[model samples]
Target chain A: MDFLIFQIPILMVQASMDGILLGILFALIAYGMALQWGVMNIINIAQGELVILGGYIAYFMYMAGIHPAFGVIVSPIVMYFVGWGLYKTIIFRVVDRDLFISILATFGISILTQQLMNFVFGSDVVVAQSNFGTTMLFNSMVTLPNSKIFAAVVSVIFAMLLVLYMRRSKLGRAIRATAQNARAAKILGVDTESVYAATFGINAALCGVAGALIAITFTLHPYVGLPYTVRSFMIVIIAGLGNLPAVALSGMGLGVFEEFSDYILGTEFRIAAVFLLLVLILVYRRFKLARKREYLK
Target chain B: MDLFKKIFSIFAAISFFVSLALPAQAKVEGDTIILGAAVSLTGKYSTNGEHTQNGYNMAVQRINDMGGVTVGGKSYKFDIIYYDDESDSGRAAQLAERLIKQDGVQYMLGPYSSGLTKAMAPVTEENQIPMVEANGASRSLFTKGYKYLFAVLSAANQYLEVAIDLAVEKNGGNPVNIAMAFEQDAFSQDVRIGVVEAAERTGSTIIIDDKLPKELNDMAATLAKVKATKPDVLVVSGHSKGALTAIRQISEMKVDIPMLAMTHCDASKLAKQHGKNSEYALCAAQWHKTLSYSDSFFGDGQQFDKDFNDMFGYAPPYQAAESAAALLVYKAAFERANSFDKEKVRDALAQTDMQTFYGNIKFNDTGQNIAKPMVLFQVRCEGDVCANRVVAPTKWASHELVHPIPSWSTR
Candidate 1:
C-alpha cells in the first residue's frame, strides 16, 4: 500500500514534466491565435498554416547546410516580412467585416497556403535535426532533451517580452486600448487601422517563431497545421480571450495535466483526458463565477 | 453563280450535320490504356501519397519507354488518370467512382492510407475494377477476400512479428516482459495485437499495452509508465510523427530497455532527427540498403543508393524502396498478363510468384504479399554520428545484434 501511494507522486511528476514541455510549445502558438482573435475577432484558421510556412522556411535553411539553431533565428525574420506583406494586402481589407466572413476568408487562405505548400514541398515529413546534448537529472533517472528545454526556455522569454511590451510600450498600450474599445481609441487619435495591421503582423511573426521551435521537436508536413490550429484555439478559449499570461499558464497546466492523465490512465486515454479537462475547467469556472455573482448581489 | 451558291449551302449544311454526329459515332480508341490513381495528393497522408505518385510516375515512364503494354499483338500506351482525394475517405470513394465510371479507367491504384482505401473498396467492388494498392495495410483490406484488390506490401501483423521474434531471441533465453504503445489507427492497432499475441506464444509477459492518440506530441508520461512497469522491451507502433515523439521521450528519460518499433521508426530520418538519443532503438522494415540481391533488378544496393540520391536529392527512405518494389511488381504483372485488360492484369497480379527489388515477390489468395522479407535495424552511436544498421534475422542482417540494451546506469 505504501509502495502504491509513493507511485502516484512519481506519476504526477512525470505527467507535469511532459505537460510543461508541451504546454510551452502550445502557449507559443496560442499567443498568435489569441492576438488574431482578440483584436480583429477574425478567428484566423490560417494561424496553423503560418506555423507550417515558418517550419518549411527553417527546414529549407537546414537543408542548405545551415545549423538548426541559426535556422531557427532566420526563419522568424523571413516569416515576419511575409506576415507583414500578407497584412498590408489581404488581411487589411477584411478587418472591418463580420466575424464569420473574416473566418471564411482566412479559411480560404489556409487552403490556398496548404495547397501551395503541397505543390512546392511535395508533402514529405521533414525534420530539422539538432546537435544539442541531453541532460540527465535525479541520478540519471529523469532525462531532459536539450532541444525541448531550449524551445521551452525560448517560449518563456518570448512570452515575458510580449507581456512587458503590452504593459509598458506606447504602441502596445494603443493596441490594447483598441482591443478593448476601438472607437474610443480612435477618438484619442490612435490610428486603429495601423494598430490592427501591426497586431496581425506581430501575431503571424509569433506563429513563425513557434513553428521554428516546433520543427526542432517534431516532423513537418503540409497538413500538420490544422491540428495545431485546433489545439491553439482550445488553449486560447480555455485560458480566456485577451489574457496572455493566463493563456500561457493554462497551456502549461493543460500540458502537465495531460501528461498526468497519460501516466495514470495510459496513453490510450490521453486525448480523452484533454477533452475531459476542457469540460471540467469550463464547468468549474462557470460555477465559481455564478457563485461570485450571487455574493455580489 | 446562283447554282454554285446553292450547292455550297447544301454542302455546308451536310458537313454541319456530320460534325455533330461524329462525336456520338466515334469509338473509344485502342491506342490508350487508362489506369486510374486515387491518392491523397493534398491532405494529411499526402507525404506517402506523394511518394506513391512518384513511384507510379517512374513506373509509367519506364513502361512507356519500353514501347508500352502489348495487348492482342498490338501495343497500347498506358496513361494514368489520377485524382487528388485530399486524404478524405468519402472523397476517395467518390473519386474512385468517377475514375471507374466517367473516365472508363479499368486498372486503379490507391487512395493511399488504409482508411481511405477501405472507404474506396466498396466502389471498386461495385465497379469490379482491379486496384493495385500501394500503401493500405489494414488486415480488413485482405480479410474481406476481395479478388479484385491486391496488396503489394506485407500486412502490419507480419512485420510486427518479425521484430518480436528478433527481440525475443536477442534477449537471451529469459522470458521477456513487454510493453506496447500504439497509435489508435488500424495499422498500429494491428501491430499491437500481433506483438501481444506473439509475446503470449513465447510465454513473455506483456506489462503494458497502451493505445495513444495519433496527434499526440509528447510521450514522457507514457514512457515513465513503461519504465515503472519495468518491461524489458517496449513496442512502439505508429506513423513517423508518433514514433519519433515516443522515441524522443523514451530516450530523454534515459530508459535503457530495447524498443521494438514498427515501420514508422524504420526510417534513417528518425536517427537524423533525434541524433545520438536514438541509439539502441530497434525497428523492423521491408527493405534495407544493405540487403544482398541479384543484379538484374536492383544492380548493387550501394549503386542503387548513389543513383537514388543523385536523382532525388536525398537518399531513398524505406518507403521509397517499398514504393520502387511495388512498381516492379506492377510491371511484372503487366508483362505476365500480356494484356492491358484490367481483369486479366489483376489475375496476373494475384498469381504473382516472382523475384523483384525488395525480395522474392509472392501474393496469397487474399492479395497480401506473402514473400515480403522483414529486416530489423538498430540505431548505434559511434563517437558523434548515429547510424541505423541492419542487425536482425541473421540471414539479412548487415550488423551483429547487440543484446541486453545499453544500460542507463552506464550512459
Candidate 2:
C-alpha cells in the first residue's frame, strides 16, 4: 500500500526492467528443473545446492584472478559430470521409486551439500566483483548494472543454445522419446538409461550457468540456495514441463511481481509475497482442474 | 524367529548408541569446570558463530595456560561443551534445555545472534544459571527483567545513533533527512529504534525506512527508492549480510548520498572485499584494534588483534573480541567468588566491573555494559588497500571523519 511506486512513475519502468532481467536468469534455472522433472520424473530438492556449487566454482575462478564471467563456460562443463556422477550414485536409485522418496532423498542431499559447502566456503556471503560497471537508462533515473545485463544476455544465449540442441541433437530426440514414455522408448531401441543420465546432466549444467550468473549478479552463501530453488520450482509450475517460451514468460512475470512487491509491499515481505503467489498459483490450478472434472461429470 | 531376533538386535544397537550419545558430565568434574554453550555452528550465522567459538576457545586456552582460575584454595581449568544451534532460535532454546537438564551444565554461554539469546534467556533465568554473553545486543533483551542473562557488549540501540548525531553535526547542526533499512531481527530492529530516536530528537524527517528480510542479498529496489528520493544520510544494519549486500548494490547502482552509515563492516570484511567501492562508509563497532583498552591476559587491543590473527589467520572482528571478553569476565567472576557455588558466581558477576583487551566490562542492572562507548570507524583507503580507521569519540580518533563522501561519478 506504499503508493510511492505509483507516485514516482519511472520506478515502474525500473522495477519492470529489473524484474525481466532477473526473471531470465530464473528461467534458465527453471528450465533445468523442468528437464529433470519431466525426463527422470524425479524432483531434485538439491537443485539449489547444485546452483550454489556452480556459483562457488565461478567464485573460485574470480579468487584465482580470472574473470568470473568466464565461469559461465567452465562451471557448466564441470557440473555436467558432477550431475552424471550424482545420478549414477544416488539419483538412479530414487528415479523409478515413489515421487515422495525422490523428494526425501534429494532433500537429504540438499542438507549434506549445504553442510559440505559451509565447511568448504566458510559460510561467508560472497559475490564475485565483475567490475563491468553500470548502464544508465532514462536520464540515469533507472540504473542497471552492466553485470546484470551480462548475466541476462548469457542466460538467454544459453537457453537458446539448449533449445537448439534439444531440437537438433541425437541425444535430444532420445530424451524427448524417453520423456514421452520410458518403456516405449526402451522398446523402440532408445537407451532410456543414458537418456535419463544425460537429461540430469544437462539440467545440472543449466543450473551451473545460472549459478555463475548469480555469483556475479547477487551475493552467494551456503543457505541462500533454497530461495533460488523455490523460485525456479514456482516458475516451472507456472510454465509447465517442456514449454520453453512459457517458462521464460513466467520467469519474467515472477521477477516483475517480486520487484513490484518489493517496492510497494516493502523488502521484508518480498519472500513472503513470493510464497503467497506460489500458494495462489497452486490453489488456482486446483480449482481449474476441479472445474474440469465437474464439467466431465 | 531368527528374523525377529535380527530386528530386535538392530533396535537394541540403536538404543545403545542413543544412550551413549547423551553427554555424561556435570558442571564441575574433578578440577575442570564445564560451561555449556549453544552457538550457530552450521547455518546463516555460522561465520560469526565460528568467531564466538574461537573466542571462547582462545580464552579457555589462555586462562588454562596461565594457571587456571584459583577458587577456594583449588585451581580449576575451564572446559566448554558446545552444541550447534544451527542459527535457529527454536533449536537454540531446545539445545539450551538439553544442556541444562540432560547434560547437567549449570553455567551457560550465550549464542551468536540476539534472537537466539532472547530464546535461551528464559531457560537460563528459570534455572538461575548466570550466562555471560558477548553478543546478543538487542535493546529488548535489556528491558526484560532477566537476572541470569548478562551481556558483555553495549545494547543494540547504541550501535548507530552516534552516526546520526555526526551527520547532523556535519550538516551545520540542522536536522537532516534520514533513510534507513534494518533487518527484521531483534538486534537490527533495536538499532532501527536507536536511529528513529535520533531522528526524532534532531527533528529530522525520515524519507525511507525499509525492513530487510532475514535472508537478504539483493537490495536494488530499496536503492532505487533511495535514488528517487535522495536523503542526507542512509543508515543500514543487518549483521554481516546486510552490510555486504548494501555496499555491493549501492556501488553497483551508484546511488549517491551525502553520508552512509552501517553496522558489521568488519564482521563482513567490507573494506577487504569491496576495497575502493566501500570507502567513506561509517561503521559502528564495539571495539577496534586501535582502541587503548588493555588487560594482562591479552595486553591491549592491538596485541589481541595480532594474537587473534596469528591464532585464527584472520583479523578478529568485534564479535570475536567481545566473545573473548565474556570468558575473561567469567574468569574474573570465578576468582572473585572464590567458590564453585552458582549463587556466589552469580553474585560475583552482578558486582563485577573490570577491563579486558576488548573493552571495559561494567554491566548495569540490566546486564548491558554501560562503561564502553561504541566506536565509529570509517573505511579509509590508501592506494588499493582499505582498512577501518577510528573516526569518532575524539578520545580514540585515529583519523579525521571525512564528510559528504565523494559521489559515485567522481569516484
Candidate 3:
C-alpha cells in the first residue's frame, strides 16, 4: 500500500474534500433511487441512464450557448415529464410485478436508452464547461474545484427541499401511504396508480439534477452511466430505503473510501474497491441478520 | 389429439435445426467479394468504431466509383458484412469465428481497438484469412508474428516517444522528471511501456506513474500527486475520454507542469470543447491533414480531410484516416495478387508498398507499417478558437513548439 497519503497530511484534506463533494452528488442520485424503490417497490436499473439523460439536457443547453448551471433548473423539469412518460408507457405495466421482472425490464430499457443516446449524441465523451474555477486552501496546497463545491451545495439544497416536500405536500403524503401499504392506500380511496407515476417521475427528476452536476464536474459518456447506477445502488443498500440522512452519510463515506483506496491502491483499483466494498457490505449484513435466524428479503 | 400434438412438436424441432443449417452466401458471390468485420456499434468504442466504419465505407465507395478491383481480367466490387461486437473482446473473437464459419467470409477487416484486434487476430490467423486492420496499434500485436495480419498504422509505442524526447530537448538536454497516467487497457498499457522505455533512454526519472481505470471519469488523485511532486512533464493516454477528463481536471486544479503530452486530443474534440483551457497541450497523432501524403483516389491529405468532413460532417481524426488507408492497402494488394486466392492475397498484403492520403503503407516483417512516422501536434488557440497545429519532426512543423506553457496565474 502507498502510505504517501498518510505522509503528506494535506493530501488527506484534499481527498476528503473531493470525496465528500463527490459523495453529495452520488447521494442525490441515490435519493431518487431510494424514493422509487420505497414507494413503488420497483428497483430501476435505468437510474444511471436517467442521470446521463439529465446531463445530456444540460450539455445541449451548453451547446445552444446557454449556461449549463441553468441545467439544474431546466433538466429536472424536462426529466420529470420524461419520467412520467416512461412510467405511462413502460413502468406502469411492470408495477406490482416481481422485483426480478422489474429489474429485467429496466435493464432492457437501460440498454435501449444507451443505444438511442449513442445514436443521438454521437457517443462522444463530453462535458459542459462551467468555468467556475478552483478554490485554493491552506496557501494553495489543497485545491478544490468551485464547480464541485457548487454541485455539493446544490445537491444538499435539493435533498432538503425534497425532504420538506415529502413531509408537507398532499401528494407526498399519498406517496408515503402507498409505500406503507399499497392495498390499504387503495382501499382508503387513494389513487395508488397516480402515486406510483409521481414517485417514478420524481426519481427521474432527481437523477436529472445529479446528471447535470456531473456534466459540469466530471465527464459524460453514454456507457459510463452503469458506474453511477452501481454507486447509487450500493449507497441505497447501505442506507436502506426511505432513509434520507443515512443515504447522504453513506454516500459521503463511500466517496471518502474511494478516494483513500485510489490513493493507497492506485486508480486501477478504484472501481474494483468500490465493487469490493459492495460485496463486503452484503456479506456482513447477511451474517449479521443470519445470527438471529433471519435473512435479507 | 395427442398424436397431433406430438407431430407438431416434431415439426417445430425440425424447423429450428433447419434454420440453424441455412447456408450463407459464398465468399465471392457473382462479381462481388465479401469481407467481414466486427466493429463496436454500441459500446465504449462506438465513436471510433463509427469512424472506422465510415472510413471503410468511404474507401469502398470511392474504389467502386473509380473502378472495382480487376482479378483475372474480371472486375469485382467490394462489399462488407459487419457485425456489432459490442466492444467486448470475447464477443469480438466469437464474431470473427462466426464470420468465417457461418457467413463464409474468407477475408476480414480488423476491429476498432487494440484489445479487440488482439482478440480477433488469433481467430483470423487460425482460419488462415487475410486481414488488414487500421486501429490496432499495440506493440505486442506486431510482436506476435502473425502471418496473415497486417496493420496500416504505426505501433502504439511510437505514439508518444517523441513527446518525451522533445521534453528532454526543451529542458536543455538534461534528464527531466516525468509523471504519466495511462488507462489499464491493451492500447494504453502499450503506450505506457513506450513512455517507460523513453524515460530510460533519456535518463529521465518518472515521479508519478499511475494506471487509470478503463472507464475513467476523474483523475484528481493522480493530478494531486503530480502537484505534490512538481514533475517537468505530465503524460496521459486513455483514448478520447481520458484526454477530455485530463484537460477538465488539470484546468480545474490548475496543476502546473512544464509540459503536458496526451493522445486522442482531436478524437475527443478537446480543442473545441475545452477551448482555451486545452491550449498548448501537446498530442500524438497518426495522421494530420497538413501532412503532404497523397494518393490518386483521395489526392493529398488536405483534399481527403475536406472530402471526409463533407461526407461525415466532422473532421476525420487520425483513427479514421488510418482506417481509410487500410482499404487502400487492401486494394493495392488485391491488384498485385491478380487473383482471389487467399494465399496469394496474403503474400500481396505482405508486399504492400504504396502511398495514400493517410501515409505510406509499407509493412515490415512483423506486419506493422514502418514507413510512416508518428507526428506530434499542439493545440493552439487564437482568440477563443483552438485548433491542433503540427509542431514536431520539423519536416511538417506548421507552427513552432510552445515550451513551458504559460502558468495559470499569468493566463
Candidate 4:
C-alpha cells in the first residue's frame, strides 16, 4: 500500500526499460540451456558457472587493455573449446546414464567450477566498463545506459545468427536429427557422439556470449552464477525447448514481472517471486493437463 | 600356528595400550591454551573468512612471539583450532558445540557474519562460554540479553551515526534533508535505525526513503525519486555490493545530488574498483589506520597496519582490524582474570574499559561497544586517480570533508 510506484508513473517506464534490457540478456542464456536440453537430453546445473567463466574471460581481456565489447565475439570461441573438452572428459560419461546421474554430475561440476573461478578471479565482484554513456528520454525522467542498449543489440544479433546456423548448416541438420532420434541417427551413419558434443559446445558458446554481455552491463560474482542458472532454467521451462520466439517473449515477460514485483513487493522478494512464479506456472499447467487424465507425476 | 596367534595377540594389545596412553597425555597435559573458531573457509563468506583467519593467525603469532599469556605460575602459548562451517549457520552451531564438548576448547572467537554468529550464540550461551566476536553487528543479537556474547566491533546501529554527526556539524547545527535507500538485510536495517535516529537528533527531514533492489541491482527508481526530491544529503545503507551498484547508477544517471554517504564503503576499495565516480562519497568506519590508538601488545595504529600488511600482503580493512582486536580483548580478559576459567573471563570482559590500536573498547550493559567512535573517510579523486582521505573529527581528519558535492557537469 505504501508503494511509490503509484506516485511516479515514470518509474514504470524506467523499470520496464531496465527489465526488458535485462531480459534480453536472460533470453540469451536461456537459449543456450534450451539447446543442450533439446539435443543432449541433459540438464546442466553448471550452466551458470559456465556463464561466469565466460564473463571472467572478458574481464581478463579488459584488464589486459582490450575493450570488453570484443569479448562478445572472443568468449564464445574460447568457451566452445572449453565446452568440447568438458564433454569429452566428464559429460560424455554421463550422457548415456540416468537423467538423475547427469544432474548429480553437473551439480558437482557447478561447485567445482564455482570454486575454480573464485580462486582464479580472486572472489571479487567485478564489472567490465564499457563507458558507453547514457540515453535520456521522457524529458530526462527515464535514463537508460548505452551499455544495456548495446547488450540487447548484440544478443539479438547472436540469436539470429544462431538460428541461421541451426537451420542451414550441415552439422546443424545432423544435430537436429540427433535431437529427433539419437539411436536412429546413429544407425544412418550420423556420428551421434560428435553431435552430442557439438550440441553441448555450441550451448556453452551461447552462454559465453551472454556472460560477456552480462559482465559489461551488470556485475559479476563467483557465487552469483546460481541465480543466472535458475533464471535460465525458469525461462526454458516457460518458453519450452527449441521455441525461439517464445523464449524471447517469455524472457521479456519475466524481466518485466521482476521489475514490477521489485516495485510492488520490495527488492528482497524478487528472487522469491521468480521461483514462486515458476511454481505457479507449473501447477496451473499440471491441473490443466490433469483434466485429460495426464498428470505431471 | 597356536604360538604365532598368541604372539600376534600380544603385539596388538601392546600397540593399543600405547595409543591410549598417548591420547590421555595429550588431553591432560596443556602446553598451550587453545581457542576455537567455526570460520567459513569454503562458502559465501570465504573471502572475508580468509581475512578473519589471517587476522587471528597474525594476532596469535604476535602474542606467542611476545612470550604468550602468563597466568599466575606458567606461560602457555596461544593456539587455535579452526573448523570450516561452509557459511552454514547449522554447521556453525554444530561445530561450536564440537569445539567445546569434544575438542576441549574453552575460549572462543566468533564467526564472520551476523547470521552465522547468531546461530553459534545459543551454543556459547548454553555452554556458558565467552565469545568475543568481530563481525556480527546486528543490534538484535545483543538485545537478547546473552551474557556470554561480547562483541569487539561497534554494533550495526552505530555504523553510520558518525556520518550524520559530521554532516550536522558541517551544516552549522542546522538540519539537512536526507534520502535513504537501504538494503533490506538485518545489518542494513540496523544501520537504517542508526541513521534515522541520528537524523532525528540532528533535525534532518526524511524527504525520500526506499529499500534498495535485490543484489543492489537496478536501483534507478530509488535514484530517480532521490533526484526528484533534491534532498540536501543522501544516506545509503547497503553492503559493499549495494554501494557499488549505487555508485554505477548514480554515475550513469548524472543525478546532481549534493552529498552522498553510505555504509560499508571502504574508500580504497571503491577507488580501486570505481574510479572518479566514487569521489566525495562519505563512509563511516569502525577503525582506520590513522587513529593513533595503541595498546601494550600492538604498537600504534600505523604500526598495526604495517604489521598486518606485512603479514597478510594487503592493507587490513576494518573487518580484519576488528578481528585482531577481538583477540586483543581476549588477551586482556585472560590476563586480568589470571586464569582460563569461563566465569572469570566473562566477568573480566564485562568490566573491560581499555584502548587498543583499533579504538577505545568499552562494553555497555548490552555488551555493545559504546565508548568507541566511528571514523569518517571520503574518496577523493584527481582527474584519473582516486584515493581515500580520512576527513572528520578534526583529530583524525587527514583531509577536509568535501560537503555538498559539486554538480555532475562541473566535475
Candidate 5:
C-alpha cells in the first residue's frame, strides 16, 4: 500500500513535467496561427509548412558551421522576408475573398511547400546538434535541454512583447484598427494593405522561430509538419480565436492532459482524449451561450 | 484489276499481324527479370525506405555487372520496378496489388517500416507473390502463418531479448527497478511488451512503464521522473527523434545507469547528434560493420560496407545491410526454385538454409528467421572518432563489458 501511494505521485509528476515542456512549444506555434486567423481572418493552413521551412533554414545554417543559437537568430528574419513576399504576391489578392477560398488557397500553398521541401531535402531526417543536453536545472533530475527551454522562453517573451506592441505602439494600433474595421482605418489614412502584409510577415516569422526550436527535440522530416498544423488548428479553435494568452494556456493544458492520458490510459488513447476534450468544450460553450441568451431575453 | 487489289490487301494485313506480335515476343524473350519495390519514398518512413532502396540498388547493380543470376542453364538480368507509397499503408497495399497484377512481377521487396509492411502482407498473400521484408521487425507479421511472407531481418522480440540478457547477466547489473520509455507505435509497442515480459522472467521489478507520444519534442520532465525512480536499467524503444531526445535528456539529468535501446537508437547518427554524451549507450543489432562472418558465395558485410562507402560517399547504415541481405536471400531462393513461378519461389524461400551479407540465414515454418546472429554494441569515443564497439558474444568484444554502471557521483 505504501509503495502504491508513492508510485502515484511519481507518475503524476512525470505526466505534469512532460505536459508543461511540450505545452510551451504547442502554445508558441498555435499563437501564430491565432494571430493570422483572428486579426487577418485568413486561415493560413500553410503555417505548419512555414515551421518546416524554418527548421530547414536552421539545419542548413548549422551544416554551414553556424552555431545553433546563431542559426535561431537568423531564421526568423529569413522567414519574415518569405512571409512578406508571399503576402504581397499571393495573399493580398485573396484577403477580402470568401473564407473557403482563403482556406483553399492556403491549403494549396501548404501542399506546394511540402512537396518543394521533399524535392530539396530528399526526406532524410535532419537535426541541429548543439549543447542542448548539458543544462540540468532541477537538481540533476528535472533536466531542460538548452534549446527547448530557450525556445519556450523566447516564445513567451515574444508573445508578451507582441501584446505590448499591439497595445502601445502606433503601428500596432493601426493594425488592430484595420483588423476591427478596415474601412474605418482606411478613412483614418492608415495603409491597411501594408499593415496586413506586415502582420502576415510577423506571423510567418513566429512559425519559423517555433520550427527552429522544434528541431532541437524532434526529427525534421517533410511530413511531420502536417500533424502539427492540425494540432495548431485544434488549439486555436478550442481556445477561441484572438485570445493569445488563452491560446497559450489551453495549449499547455492540452499538452499536460495528453501526458497524463499517456500515463494512465496509454499513448494510443491520447489522440482519442484530445478529440473527446474538444467535443466537451464545444458542448459546454454552446450550453453557456444558450443560458446567456435566455438571461438577456 | 480486282484480283491485283485483293493480293495487295492480303499482303498489308500479314505485315500488320507480324508487327503486333513483335512486342509480345520481345518481352518474353528478354533475359531480364523484374523485382517490384513498393517503398515509402516521400513521407514519414522515407529515411528507412531510401536506405533500403539504396542497398537493393547497389546489390542489383553489382550482380548485373557480374553477369547476372545464372539459373536453369541461363543468366537473367534484373531490373527493379519501384513505386513510392508516400508512407500511406493503404497506398502501399494498392501499390502491392498493382505491382503483382498489372506489372506482372513475380517477387517484391519491402515497404520498409513495419506498418507499411503489414499493410502489404495480405495483398502479397492474396496474390501468392513472395515478398522479402527488408527492415520490418514486427513479430505479429510472421505469427499469422502467412507462407508467402519471409523475414530477413531479426524480429523486434529477438533484439529486445538480447538487450535484456546483456543488461541483466553480462553487465552483472540487477534488472530490478526497470523503466521503459518508448514511442507509441506498433514497433515500439512490441519492444515495450518484450521488456515487460523479460523483466518478469528475470525477477526484476518494473518501477515505471511510460509511452511518450509520437513526435514528442520535449522530454525534460520525463527524464526527471526516470531519474527519481532511480531504475537500475532504463530501456528506450524509439526511432531517430525519440532516441536522440531520450539520450539528450538522460545526459542533461546526468543520471548514469545502464541503458538498453532498440535498433533505432543504435545508430552512428544518434551518436553524432548527441556527440560525446552518447557513450555507454547499448543496443542489439542484426549486423554491425565490425562483426565478422565466414566468407562464402554470398558477399561479406565488411567488404560490402567498403564498396558501399566508396560508391555512396558514406558508410552504409545497418538498415542498408538488412536491405541488401533481403535481396540476396530472394536471389538464392529464386535460384533454388529454378523457376520464376511465384508459388515455387515462395516454397523455396520457406525452406531456405543459406548465408548472406549479414550471416547464416534460415527460416522456420512461421516465416521467421531461425538461428539469426544478434550483436550488442556500446558507443565509445576513440580520439576523435566515435563508433559502436561490438561488446557481446564475448568473442567480438574489443574491451571487456563494463558491469553495473558506476554511480553518477563517482563518474
Candidate 6:
C-alpha cells in the first residue's frame, strides 16, 4: 500500500550497500560450489548446511567466551574434516556415477545435516555477534554495519587467498589436472581420488568461512541451509565453473538483484524472486545454447 | 529444454503433493462427550502444537478428575478425539470435517495458528458445531460473523494496541516515529495492521514499514534501513524467528534506536543468549505469572504457570493458558445447558460468562473475548540475570516501564 523507497531515496543507497555486502558473502559460498563442481564434477546440495554448521562452530566459540570473528579461521578447519569424512563415507561413492545420484545423495545429506543441526542447535535463530559497530556515510543517511563491511572484506580476502592457493599450491595443481582429465591425471600419478576428496573438503571449508561470516553479519537457523544451497548452485550455473571474476560479479549481481527485488516486490516474494531469477537465467542460457546449435545446423 | 523439463517436473511434483486430499472415515456412538480437535502435532507449529495439546489434555484430565461434565443428572467423561494436522491448514480443515461429519463430534477446539483456525472454522460453522479455540487471535476471524466460531484469547489486532498505548504514554506525549519489520504470515500481518492503527492513534509516524524475508532468516537489510532513518522506536512483528533476527541484527549492526518492541519478544529466549542487549525490549503478552486471575479448575494464574512448567518443562505461553480456558468455557456451557444436545450446548456457549486462570471469559457478540486485556512485558536485566516483568497498565506492572531505551553507543 505504501512505497517507502520512493519517499526515502537514502534507502536506495542503504539497500544497494547491504545487497552488495550480502552478495559478497553469497558469492563466497557459491565459489565453493564452483570449485567442487569444476574438480569433483558433482553438485553438492549440502553447501548451505556446511555454512550453517560452520556458523554453529563460530556460535559455539562465541558462547565459550571466544570472539566470533575468529570463527572465520576456526570453522573451516573443522568443516574441512567434515567434508573429507563425508567424501570418504558417501560423496566418494556418488563420484563417477550419474550427476543425478550426486544431487540426490547430497540432498539426503542436506536433510540429515539440517535435522542434526536442529537437534544440536535447538532450532532457535542464533547469531554470533562481531559487534564491529557501524560507519555512517552521507551524514548518517546511509548506515553501514562494520560487521557486514568486515564480512565483505574478509570474503574478498578469502577469495583472493583461495585463488592464490589454487595457482601456487601442489594439491591445487593436482586438483586442476584432475578437473581437466581425471583419467589422464590418474595415469600421471596425480591420485585423482584423493584430489576429489580434497576438492570437496576445500569447497566445504569455503562454505565454512562464508557461514561464519553469515553468523556474524546475519542470523542462522538449522533449516535455512536450502536457500544458501540454491543460491550457490544458481551462482555457479550463471558464472560457470573455473571463472573467478564472473562468479564474483554475478554473485554481487544476484545480491543487488535480491535487494532491489525486496524493495520492488517486497520481502514475501524475495525467495520466490531468487528462485524465479534462477529459472529465468537457465531458460535464457538454454535459448542462447539452442541458437548456437541452430547456427551449426 | 532440459532445464525447463526439470523445473516443470519439480513444480508438478510439488503440486501433486499439495493437492493430495484425504478421505474422512469415522463414526461415533456413545454417552461419552466427544471434543474433536484438528491440532498441529508436527511441522513448524509443532512446538506451539504441543503447548496447545497440553492445555487441552490437562483441562480434560482436570475436568474428568472432578467426574467430568454432568448433563441432566448424567455424568459423562470427556474424551477428545484429536487428529494431527501436520501444521497444514488444508489438512486441519479436512480433519475438522472428519471430526464433525464422520465421527459425529459435536464440539471442537481450534488449531495452533490463526491461519489453521481460519481453515478449520468454516467446516465447524457449516456443520453448526460449536468450536472454541485458544490460540487463533486474528481479528478477521470474528468479523466474519461465523456463529459457531469462538476464540478464548484476545484478538490479534489488539495485541499491539496496548503496547502502543504504553509507548506513547512513555514517550511523554511527543510524536514518535516507528519503523516496523513484520513477517508476511497472517498473524504477523494482523500485528502490522494493529501497530499501524495504534501508531496513528498516538500521532506517531511510520517512517519505514518493511516485511521480513519469508524465511525470517535475515533482517540486516531492514535494520540497516532502520539505522538510516533513525526512528524513535523500531517495531518487529514477525513471529519468534523474526523477532530473534531483529534483536540479533540490531546488536550486530550497532543500530541505535530509542526503543525496540516486538510481538514475540517474550518467546525470543534472549535471556539465555543476549540478555544484556535484550534489556528493555518490550513485548505484548496475554498471560503472565503476575496476573492474579483465578478460576476453580486451574487455581490462580500463577499456579497454572507452575503446573504447566512442571508438566512441559517450559513456561506455558498465553496459547496454552487460553487453550485451557477454552475447555473451561466448554465445561461451563455444558453445565449451563444441562443437556448433551448440540443445539443446547451451542446456545449455552453463546451465552457463556465466567473467569479462568487465564483471564475473564466473556464473549462479545462476534464470539471474541473482549474482556482479556493484553499486558505489556519487558526484559529486566540485572547483571547476568534477566527476567520478564509486566511493565504496563500500572495495575499489571510488576515493575516500572523502561522508556527511551539507551542507544547502542550509550550502552
Top candidate (TM-score): 2
Interface RMSD (Å), each candidate?
Answer: 2.7, 1.6, 1.5, 2.6, 3.7, 3.0
- In candidate 1, list every pair of residues with a backbone clash: A19-A255, A19-A256, A268-B211
Write one digit per residue (lDDT tens) for candidate 5, span A232-285: 888988888778878988988998887776555655467678879988999999
> Candidate 6: deviation at residue B405, Å?
2.5
Tell me the docking grade of candidate 4. acceptable
Candidate 6: residue B256 lDDT (0-100): 82
Candidate 6 residues B1-411, lDDT tens each? Answer: 999999999999987654443213222245578789988776556767878899998888889898888878878777789899977888998998877766667889889989999999989888888899988999889889999888888888888777667667767887688888888878888888898899888888887777766664777667766766688888888777777777776776678876777787655566555667688888888788788789777899889888888887888877788788899899889899997677888888989878788888888888999887888888898887988899876887889877778767778
The segments of candidate 3 whose C-alpha lies over 4 angstroms from its true place after superposition are A283-297, B1-33, B67-77, B83-91
Q: Which one is best on DockQ?
A: 3
Q: For residues A50-100, what per-residue lDDT tens digits would candidate 1 score against the true structure?
A: 998988887787888887666556777777777778878888888888988
Q: How does residue B353 of candidate 2 score in lDDT?
A: 93
What C-alpha lDDT, on a 0 to 100 scale, does residue B288 get in candidate 2? 91
Scored against the true structure, residue B113 in model 2 reaches a CA lDDT of 86
For model 4, residues B1-411, the per-residue Cα lDDT tens digits are 999999999999998776555423332137687888999888767778888898888888888888887777678787888999988899999999888776766778999999899999999899888889998999998999999998888888888877777767778888988888888788888999998999889888887777764454567667776766688788887676777777888888878777788876772277777788888988878888888899887798889889888887888888888898888888878889987677988999999999988899999887888878777788998889987788876788899988779887788
Cα displacement (angstroms), candidate 2, residue A158, comes to 0.5
Which regions in candidate 4 have their CA more than 4 angstroms from the true location? A283-297, B1-31, B165-177, B199-209, B212-216
What is the C-alpha local distance difference test score of each model?
0.75, 0.91, 0.91, 0.84, 0.76, 0.83
- What is candidate 1's DockQ? 0.50
Q: Between the candidate structures 1 and 5, which one is better when assessed by lDDT?
A: 5
B388 Cα displacement, candidate 2 (Å): 0.7
TM-score of chain A by itself in each prediction = 0.90, 0.97, 0.97, 0.96, 0.92, 0.96
lDDT of candidate 3 over B230-271, digit per residue (tens): 899999999888999999999999998899999999888999
- Candidate 6 at residue B230, lDDT? 80
Alpha-carbon shift of residue A4 in model 3 (angstroms) = 2.3
* Number of the candidate with higher lDDT, 2 or 4: 2
Q: Please give, for residues A158-205, the per-residue lDDT of candidate 4 as tens digits.
A: 999989998999998999899889999999999999998898899889
What lDDT is obtained when candidate 5 is compared to the true structure? 0.76
- For model 1, the superposed segments whose C-alpha errors exceed 4 Å read A1-8, A57-61, A64-67, A70-76, A284-297, B1-33, B60-79, B266-268, B292-315, B318-345, B380-388, B408-411
